[model samples]
Target: MMRRLSGLLLSLCLFPVPAFAQSKPCTVSDHPEYTNKIKEFTTESFFSTELVDHLPLSSCVPPPDAFLHHIIGAPDTLDYTKDINAYFRLLASKSPRVKVWSIGTSEEGREMLVAAVSDEANFAKLDRYKEITARLADPRGLSEAEAQKLIAEGKPMYWADGSIHSPETGAPEMLMELAYRLAVEDTPFIQKIRNDSIILITPIVEVDGHDRMVDIYLQHKKHPDKPPYPLIWWGHYVSHDNNRDNLGVTLALSRNMLKTYLEFHPTVMHDLHESVPYLYIMTGTGPYNAWLDPIVISEWQEMAYHEIEEMTKRGVIGVWTHGFYDGWAPNYLLSIANNHNSIGRFYETFGNGGADTRVRTLRPSETSREWYRPNPPLPKVKWSARDNINMQQSAILFGMNNVASNGQKFLSNFYLKSKRAVAKARTEGPVAWVFPADDSRPAEQASLLNLFVLQGVEVHRTERELRLRATESGRDPDAHKEKSAEMSAEKSAGKSPDDAKSKEEKKPAETVIRAGSYVVRMDQPYSRMADMVLDKQYYNVSDPRPYDDTGWTLGALRNVKRRAHAQSRQNRCSRRHRRPGQNLPHPAQYRQHARDFAFPPRFRSHGSRGRFLRSRRPEI
Candidate 1:
C-alpha cells in the first residue's frame, strides 16, 4: 500500500496534476495585498533582489507548491507527514545537491528523515568530510601543523531541525521551503553556503506529534464555535518532556539524534522552536554549566548575536537574546552537541497554532524595550502562520550564511576545543575515574558504564586490583593518618600543634581500586562530558531560578560506586585487557549469577511459585 501511494506521489511530482479540492484552500486572492506584502518582505529583506534574481529554479525539481497545491504557509492549510516525506524524496531524486535518508523510526513507527543538502561535489566526497570531522573531534595524534591542514581542507557541517514540539506548526512548513531553496537555488549566497558547509535538515523531529497535532488543528478549524479538541499527549510517552531525554537517551528520537551527532560531528546544531515574543535566538541566561568549555559559551553568543544583528538590519523586529533560559542544565536534546564541543543553539519564534491570521495582544513585559530586545514587538498586532514562517526562515538563512562565511574559524575552533580537552587531563587533576564492579548490583554497574560508552566516552576494564598513591595534597587518607601521628608526637614533645599539623597536611595519600573495575581516563577528547555526567553539580544559590532540574549526577541516580582519583602515577592493573562491551557481563548473566547464589534455608524458594513458602519457627 505504501509503495503504491509512493508511486502515485512520484507520478504527481513528475507530471503536474490538477489542484486537489479542499473544504477551504487558502488562495492569494483571499488576501492578495497581505500575501504580496509577506512575499516582498521575505524576498527583499531576507534574500535581497540581486540574490533572488540569480536563483535558477529548475523545472525538473518540484517546488513545495507542487505537492501542497498552494503556497507554503497558506492560511488554514496543513500537509500530512507522508506528503512531506514524498516531497523530500522527490527533491533527492531530482537534485544532485540533496540526499535524504531515514535516521530511524519514531515512537509511533513513522520514519524520521534527515536531508543533507550541499554542493554536488560535496555529496561525492561526503565520506571524506565525515572522516575529517571525526579526526578533528578527537585531535590526539595530529600535530598543530597537521590540524591546521585538515581545518583548511574540511568544510563545517551545520545541522538544523524543526517541529520538535509539533504545535509550533511554522517550523516544519518553513523547513520544506528552506530545503527547496538550498537544493534548487543557485545564487551566489546559496552556492557559497553549499560550497563551504554541509547543511543537514530534519524537517520534523517528533513525527508522531506532528501528525497528531495536524489532526487536532484541522478538527478545531472545522468547528470554529466549539471548544477545541484536546491532544492528551504529543509523543506517545510524553509531551514537552520529549526534549528532556538527551542525557538518558531513553527515547528513540533522542537515540537517533545522538547517533547522527556521533556520525557527522556537525560544528553547529540548530533546533527551531516557537513561543517567544517574535524570535528568541538562544544565547542563554547564566549561570552556565561549569563543565562546558568557555569557548562553547562564547560560540553560542557569536551565532545568536549574528542572527539578531542580521535580522534587525533586515528591518525585522522583536529578534532578541539572553533572558529566557539558563545554560546550567545539559539535559536538552541539543545539549548533546554542546557537551561534545560543538555549538548547539535554537530559535523561538511567535506562532499561532494554525495558518489562520489572528489578532494577539502582548503583555507590557513582552512589549517593553530592553538591552537585549532593541525593537520589541508591538503591544497588539495581526499575526499568522505565514508571518511565523517568514521570521524563522529568515533567521535560519542568516545563521547558515554566518557559518558558511566563517567556515575556517569554526573548524579551527572545534579543533582547538578538542585539543584543550586532552591537554586538561595532563595539566589538571582527576586523571581518571574508576567505577568498581559490585557483586550485589552487577547489572546496575554495567548499565551505568554502558551509558558512558553510548555517549562516546572511552572506557576500559581493570584486569587486576589497582593501587596507587594519591599525589594531590587533600586526596591521601594514609598520608593524613601518618601526619596526624607525627603531629601528636611533636605536640607531646612541646612543639606547636599548628606547625606539626601544617607539615602533615602536605603529604600524599593512597587509594586501592578493586579488580574488574571500569576506568574512564580523562585524557580523551570528551572527558568534559564524562566529568559532567559523573561529577556532582553545584548550582549557585544566588543565581536566578534554573529553567529545569538543577542537578543530574548519574552515579548517585544509578546507585553506582564511582571514584575520581587525581593520582599521577600509572598503575599496571589499570590496563585495558578487552573492550568495555566485552568485559561487562550481560544483564542475563547477572540474573543467572543471582540465581546461582544459595539463599538461607528459611528464605529459600521451594517451588515454581518462587516464594519463601516455608520458614523455620523461631526458638523461644
Candidate 2:
C-alpha cells in the first residue's frame, strides 16, 4: 500500500494533466438566446425562487472534486479558480482535437497549465495539408474540408484567459461560459468554431495565487454563499495578491515557462487581472484602447467591447471597458513591458493584448479604488494615445518600426564589424550591438567609443549601481589587460577614424539585457555597459506593462535630456554613471559602473512638452 501510494503521487506529478482533467460535464444551450434563458431564471419572476433553489452549490464544499466548479454559501465573490479549471476540463472532454499542459509552478506552487486546441487527426495527415486547406474555402461549399484553411491563414481565433491577480475574479468566472460553449461536441457554436479556428488557452495565468484565493473562500463563506460571494478567502497569502509580476524567488520558474510559451509565438496574449472600484465606476480593463493600436483600435473596440457592453445591458455585471473605469491591463503592460501584453505583440504574434474588466461588477455607489483608474478624460485620452507610446516600447521586446521578424540575421554583424574595427586599430576587438532607444544608448551616443571589455555579462542585477556587461572569455585579467589597453588607446585618441569603417562599426555600440543580439554596444565612452531593469512591471502590478530595469515611463521622459549630466539630474527614476564620452580608465569597475539609459532620437522633443504632454497620455 505504501509503494502504491508513492507510485500514485509520482504518477500524478509526472503525468501530463489529461485533456478531460480541466473540466466536467455541462449542459449548454445557444448563448445567443442567453437573454431569454436568463430571463426565466431572474429573481423577479414568479418561478425565480424555484429556479434559484435548483442552482448548483457543490463548489462550496471542501471544494467540488474536478467537476462542480463552485457553490455559493452566504454572499461574497464567485469561485473564479474552480470555475475556470472546471470549465477548461469540460473543453478537453468534448473536443477530440485539444491537448493541454501545465507549464510552470506558481507563487503558491500550483500547476500553471495551458491548452492547445487544434485538429490533431487532420494535422497528422501531412500529405493532405494543402488539399485540406483548399477544401475549407471551396467555392461550391461542398468540399469536405474541416477548418484547415482558417488554421493555415491564421484568422483571428480568440484565446483569452484571466485572473493573474486572484481577487480580480470575474474574468476566470466569465471564461466558464466561454468554455461551456466550446467544449460540448453537439453544439452548433462549438462545431463552427472548431471548423473555423484552433484555439489555445492558459485559463489561470496565475494559478498558484488564484488557488490560494479559491481555497480560502472554500474554507469560509462557501459552505456556510449567495448569488455573489465577496471578501473571498480572507485568509491565504495576502502578500501574493497582485503578483502577476515575477517575484525574486520565482525568477527561474517565470523565465522557463515564458520561454516555452514563446515557442508557440501566439497571435494574441491576454494578461488578466482584477480592477479596483470607487476610482473607476463605469467600466474596467478591456480591448484595444486608442493608446495601443489606432488602425485596428476601432475594430477591436467594436468586436470585444460592443459584445461586452451588450452583456452589461443585461444583468451581467462588470463586462466592458470605458471612461468610468477604463483601466486597461493590456494597455499598461504593452506600454512598458514592450507590447508582450499589447494587441500587436504579434511578432510574438499579432492581436495579442488580452485583458479583463471590472466595469459593472461593483455596486453602483460602492468603491473598490485599489486599481489605478485615471480620471474620465485622462483614461480616454490614454486609450487614444497608447498606440504611439506602445509603438515606441515595441522596439525593446523586438525592435522599432512595428516590424516583426524572427531568425538570426545580425549576431555576426556586430562581431564582424568589431573585428574589423579592432584589426584596423590592430587592437583586440570589442563587439557590441547598438540601439537608438536603450537607456544605455545615450552613453554610447555621440562619442569616443569605449571597449565593452572581456568580462562575463552579468544577466542579473539587484541595484541600479551594479549592472551586467558582455564578456567574451573567462575571468583572466592579463588577456583583458591587453585588450583593454588597445581599446583604451582607441578612445583616448581624440578623433574617430575618418574611414567609414562599415557603419556597423562606426554607428554607436551597445550592450543588451533580456534578449536580442543586434545594435548593442559598450557605453558611449566607457567599457562599462548599461543594464536593463527587466522586472519593472512584475514588481508593480499597479501598472502591468512590460519593461526591463532600463525602462522608464514616457511620463518620466518629460524631465529627461539626451546628455548624461542632464538625464541623471532630470529623471528621478534614472541613475547616472558619467558624461557621455567618459571612458573607464580601469577594467575592474566596468560591471559596477555600467548603467542602463534611454535617450531615443524621438526623445529630442519636437519643440516642447506643452503640446506633447496632453497629446501622448496613454501607451497605445
Candidate 3:
C-alpha cells in the first residue's frame, strides 16, 4: 500500500490539474470564504429579510480547477487575453446577467468588445434605459412628466475602461475577474448592485496594443538580457500620447471607444491607469480638473466623496481624491464624460512589475505627501502585479457601488446639470459664435466644421443674416470706431464720404454680417466644450492653474472668422432674405478683398455679379 501511495503522489505532482478542469457548475463551495464574507456584509438592517430570501444561495464561484483559480496561483503579469477570452466565454455561456457586444474593430483589426451587465429586467429593457440616459444627458425635447418618470426608474450607468495604455497591465486583467464576480455572484450586496446599476465595461480599449504587448513579453521572457519592463507600445501610431486624441479623435481606438461612450451616455465614467514606481503611498490616487462645468463638477465631487467613503468601508487601502487630474483638458477620453455632464474620474493605480518578477520595494516618504495623503495610517507598500490589480479592482468596484447606491439622485443630477450648463452659457456672453459658411478659405472653414462635428459640438447653418452691432461682433472695435469718427468728420464737413473716400483708405469700413453663417450656440449642453475649442482662452492668467493646454483655440489658429454675439441680436432673419438683384459685391471684389487681407483666396468664383458669397467669422 505504501508503494502504491508513493507512485500516485509522484504522478499527481508531475501532472498538475488543467486550468479549466471539471465541467461542473461553479458554486459557493469553490470559495466558501467569500460566502461567509458575503453573509457578514449583508447582516445590516437595511438588507431586509425579503432581500435575503431572494438572494441565490450558491454564489457563482469559479471551480477551484478553473482558469481564474489557476491565474491566482500564477503571477499576475502573464498574457491575460487568453484568460479574458476563456472567462468571457464562460460568462456568456452561463450568466444571464451578462451580454457582450462588439462595438467596433481597432486599427490593427483586433475585435473591440463592450460588455453590458445588469439584472435580467434591466438587460431586457437595456434599449429603453439607454434612451432614458440619452434624454437625461440632453433634455431638449424631454417632457417634464417623461423626464420625472424616467428619473424615478433610472439606474446609474457605470462605465469603466481598462488598459488603453498597454503599460497599465493591471486594469485589463483585473477587469476580467471583476466582470466574472459581478456576473456570477448571487449575494444580496451584489444583487443590489446589479439591480440598482447598469455596468458597461470595455475590457481593453487598445486591443491591438494589448495583443502586441503580450506577444512581445512572451517572446522576450527567455532572453538572457531581457529588459526589466515589457517593451510594449500602448497605441498603434501615437503610443502613449494616444490618450490625448479625444478632442480630435485621431486614432481608430479612441474613435470607436468614444462612439460607444456617446451611445451609452453613462452616469459615471472611470478610466483606469497605472502610476509610475513608488511616487505615492496610495493604491489609486489622482486629482480632478477644477475647471469642469460647475454644476457637473459639484455632482462629480459628491460621487467622488461617496466613493472615498465606500472604499474605506470596503477596507480598500490608501485612496485619495480631488487635486491631480482636472477635467478642463478636453484631450482625454474621460473629459468626454466631463463635457457631456457625466461624473468622470481617472484612477491611477501604482504599478512596477515585470512578467514574472516584482520590481522595487516602495515605502512612505516625504515625497509621498506631495502627491497623496494617506488614509489615517498608511498601509505597507510592496510592488507587485497582484497589488496593482487589487488597488484598481477596489477603485472600480467601490466607485461603481457608490453610484449604484444613489442611482436616483444621479439620474436627476444628470438632467439638471445639463440645464445648468445652458443657464451658465446664457449668463456668460457671448450668446453665440457665428462663422460664415461662405468664406475666402471655404476648404479651411469646412475642415474646421468637420473637427467641430467630431468633437460633438452642435452646429447650425443660418437661414438668413443675423444682424448684430459691428462693435459687439468680436472684431477690433477700435478700427470700426475710428471709421465711425471719420464718417462723422466727413458728415460735419458736409462732404459725401462714399464719393470722396481716399483710394488707399486707412479707416476701417463698417461691416454687416451676411446670412449662411454656421452658428455655434452657447446655450447648449456641450457649451463648455464648444467654448473651450472655439473661444480665445488665456494661459495661467490667475492664481489657480489650469491642468493642461492653457491656450488652445483651434478656430482662431486656423484664421477662421468668429463673429461673437456679445449682445443679443435685434433682427433674427436667419434664412434667405436677400433680394436677388441687391447690390451684392462682384466675385472679383471678393477676390480683391481676399488678396487685400492675408486670407486664402480659395473661394469659388460664381460670376461677375458675385453669386458666390464668401464669409468668415472675424478674429477676436
Query: Where does candidate 2 have its weakest 10-residue lDDT segment?
Result: 611-620
Taking all chains together, each candidate's TM-score versus the true structure is 0.83, 0.43, 0.74
lDDT of 3 by residue, 145-253 (tens): 8889989877789988878888667677767767766776666667777989999888888877777777666666666487545554565767787887777666777
Residue 467, model 2: lDDT of 18
lDDT string for model 1 (137-255, tens) is: 88877888998998999999999998878788887888887888788666687788998999998888898999999998898889889998887789776889889888887777887
How much lDDT does each candidate structure score?
A: 0.75, 0.31, 0.60
RMSD of 3: 11.3
- Regions of candidate 1 where Cα sits further than 4 Å from its true position: 1-56, 470-509, 573-583, 587-589, 593-620
Ranking by TM-score: 1, 3, 2
Q: Which candidate is the best by lDDT?
A: 1
Pairs clashing in candidate 1? 476-509
Question: Which candidate, 1 or 2, would have the higher TM-score against the true structure?
Answer: 1
